[model samples]
Target: MTPARQKLLIVTRHTPLPWEDGAGAYLHDLARYLATDGFRVHILWLAPHDRLRWKKIWRLPAPFARAVRLHLPGALRLGRRFVFLAVVWLPFKARALDRVRRALNTVGLAPPRRHPSPAPPAAAPLWASPPTPAELALVVRFFEKHRPDVVITNYAWLCPILDLPALRRTCTACLTHDIGWQRAALSAPGIAPEITRDGEAAWLRRAALLVAISETDAAELAALAPAARVVVAPKACETRAPFAETTSRSLLFVGSDNAFNARGLDWFLREVWPRLLREVPDVSLHVCGSIDRLVTLCPDGVAFHGPVPDLAPCYRQAALVIVPLLQSTGLNIKLVEAAACGRAIVTTPAALPGAPFLRDAVAVAATPGEFAAAIRHLLDQPAVRAATAARALAAVRARLAPATCYGPLAALLRANAVARHDVARDLRVLHASGAHPPQP
Candidate 1:
């Protein structure tokens, strides 16, 4: 007899083709691992018409570079400046303005786009910036046809249960990257309640399992959807990647243009960055990312390298990695990447949680003054910086290994409906055949 094939349909915000941003990288790694594990996989993601031509790029090394560029804030800072200039300088042609706005929206800036969004006549939309009916319908049909044994989606925004009702019957799992509704509520007031009502909250309640990257996040999910299954799926860094270090170094900060990251950078630049630059005049601050709202007009020593294929080189040369996040609810992947690169990290206590870093294990600082003072202190002491980097690397290796992080995820997912049915059927036959004897 032949063995049955195990099929999985992964519905994500972006197709898991290449490593781009956090969510895109998540899907990419999942698909690659699952495919290697002998599961038949179908990926569903949103891609612009322009990106369709480069579909093959997802399988190539170049896309990995694109992913880095997309996530880095420095590069994005430049783009925002141009957009700001366009908003002010460009003619107010409504149709042209709409096109520009849509294009900008797709870019995913930290701050909201300037132009008005095109929406059909309704009292209020389902989401803050809801997907179109056409987009949701396409997702529904794609999942239905695939008829996967397991259906995994990102979060409630892209995978509302009401929109894709068929997914309820399937073994559904969602990787809660961050509580979008929570972040919206925190960053943009009064927006969360509306988006949550449109089915985001209910979808979480119905999900077979919800995976949060941190304990802080899992707790938040519990508050929102009390009855749902939620698990903390910690984030990890890629341990092996090669690069060379340069002698002249500066403090490095990298993140995509999200309101959370932007807030962090704004604080750093406003409070911490100026002080650090003043102390170390020649020390260059390299801001590498796509979103450019904050990093534009960076000072003399501050060079904004829009985006790079590999951050390993930057990490190698960097004296310290700064994660100055004020408002966020999950593990910072950029910090993980820094650890994997063996760079000393200076971040607010809020940016890093449950890392065992505060008890002199790995992390430092809780305020801008302390953060700036720490960066300056580390720069003055080469030995301390080197030692800290070594310890940080060891901490990452021991705790944040990809295998260590994904192990819990795999176990939880395997216990879902599809895996349970498969296990039950096998056990039933074994019991019926009296293959097991009574224990003494």
Candidate 2:
């Protein structure tokens, strides 16, 4: 007998319509795969990244307009400041300091007469504003209209939409990229109690299921609500053709517009690459991604290919794929994709955390000097590169496949529906005893 089809509603801020970024690509693959498995999936995406384009398809009437109106002014105010800090503050500080130092050198100014560069300001406090009443109500209205049997959302920001006492009575799953309130609280030492207290914590505990992207992330959520069902689902990319290694002299780095990747690239370029270049004169670095700023800041010998739909060429033309990341909190999809393509990897400990590929096989580096040495060592030996490439591909095939990672996701969704029904009976008994007030 054929399996029964289930209806699902997926809510996300990003989904691949134009095949643009990582989140969109992941969502597209997920939706397609789920549909192929006999799911009737209806996706309600916010498409905040390309709002104008999405607006043309599903136009909202005036009632929905009034709901988002209250938060518009605050979002606009903070968003403007965010752009100024990123495009203006940080780069201006770097350039201004360079100019002042040059002037001091020309005038032969002593240390006492020279002024030091100012420290760049900290990143704007993340998620500083809570969702407006209008936004939350709009979500509830959308949910009622769709009346989905199951709901899956990517972030905790959608909590206000699904956290109603009545809504919690239904099946809800939160695919946590990161816990917004917890991240905000940790990123900023202290924030207003109103924003982080009952608001976010309540929504998290009420979630029927939580899907965490990494083990570390799962552990964090487990601590918050030990009884809540949770699953760890690692990110995966569709297999691409092997990147042919034509040169024993070039390295590759790729990412699009993430601050963490930008910092990672800067560290590699400034501290690691120069050391490798000294040992290998013909060494070339090819950058593929959408960060235009990195090109201007990159050294003279480096090459930049803005944005390529197919990343195979960048990997194909390399000696080895380099991941010199130090401080990112989640999985590095780039490292896994490179390994899947049978390319040799030289990465930092932070870059390969919980990754099985590096037990004794792939090269690991803890410092800039160590990373540089590893790159140099790999470049010099063809035999080591060949062996490393084979092992890297085998590890990814064994551990990083979608079926291996997402099994827990299916199990957790099933458990969430059961858990919600069980909890509802207990709540009713307590209310009847007058131990707690009835919730409507």
Candidate 3:
């Protein structure tokens, strides 16, 4: 008989939505690969990324239509929490609503709240808080009943679930997106509780296996928890067929409204953007995705085209992509995406740790002056830009394809499954001999 597919479950608050953000895209690619490569993938997640879509909701319906769409039946289907969300924030999102909601809840009259409400990505304190006891109870019950061969969770914060007694019979893995303490760099002062190195290290130790998104992140994580098995699996991508390079003098930036994108965009506007325009005055920069909401200002020549379901049209129109990130951790998936799309790029050294193969393929500039010059140089020479874009596309085809990126993780899991099966056989033989089963 053919061997049964190994069962694997992903536990995360950051639900996978390929277009939502880099983390979402990473998880989506991971799930797709696992499902195809001998694993029956399951998920225990909180909410779909940004279910509110506050920025795009107005554009969604004809005037006054969506307001009517938020009726009682809609609330039932979405659960009680959706009703609270619709009333407390959707129609007229105001500071005064906070007072109204508080008064209702204080009198035990709050709207039916049956589910966990979605928080804005990376901005809410909820991102750092551990699940309530009741929530963790549900997770424990599911883990015990399912008894998956492997359990992979996205964040170190969720490692609490990885420590369940059931894990002794399962391979627990923590998918480390980045060094958690590095989040302190992007957060506002006093808003986030101190995320120390020791705290991060402690969380990582709960898992038997650790998956890192980059070599740099893996090295740090390995140092943090020397006993935890660490494997580097860079974010997965598809190698797109070579597309004609754009002659249009437009630059594209795609990101979510998270702190990292906000910080990088803020720095770009304050320091790098003006310098870029001084050289290429007629050139336009098209900003895509939710990151637009985080920026307070959009100067002339820069356009914010909020979140879209499709990025193909945006990619096709831009001459080059710019990633002027001053601070970030792990792999910058956006950099890999631009390369996969065959777009010439002008980026900073900060974005290269995850995809070092990109270092030679794209233009790398360190300072604001140099960054602007690189963009200007690519803009002025279409031949050079196309050649560079071609090089980037080639690099992704060779190195960033899903098989190339996800293979090592797959190999490790397969080996563990065989080991687990052998251990089960030993236990059966011990049972026949009236001997106690060995601890896993």
Highest lDDT among the candidates is held by which one? 3
lDDT of 1 by residue, 117-200 (tens): 687554423333445566567667766666666767666665463346666455677777777766666676645354453256
Candidate 2 lDDT:
0.64
Candidate 3, residue 279: how far the Cα is off, in Å: 3.1
lDDT values, one for every candidate: 0.63, 0.64, 0.77
TM-score for each model: 0.72, 0.69, 0.80
Ranking by TM-score: 3, 1, 2
Per-residue lDDT of 313-397 in model 3, one digit per residue for the tens? 8989999999988777888989988888889999888788778888999999988899888999999999999999989888888
lDDT of 2 at 331: 59
lDDT of 2 by residue, 121-221 (tens): 54332333434565455556666765555677656666555666447666787776655554455434555543463555566676668877678777877
Instruction: Report the candidate with higher lDDT, 1 versus 2.
Output: 2
Candidate 2 at 309: error in angstroms?
A: 2.5
Question: Residue 178 error for model 3, in Å?
Answer: 1.0
**Candidates in order: C-alpha RMSD to true structure:** 11.2, 13.5, 7.9
Clashes of 2: 0
Top candidate on TM-score is 3
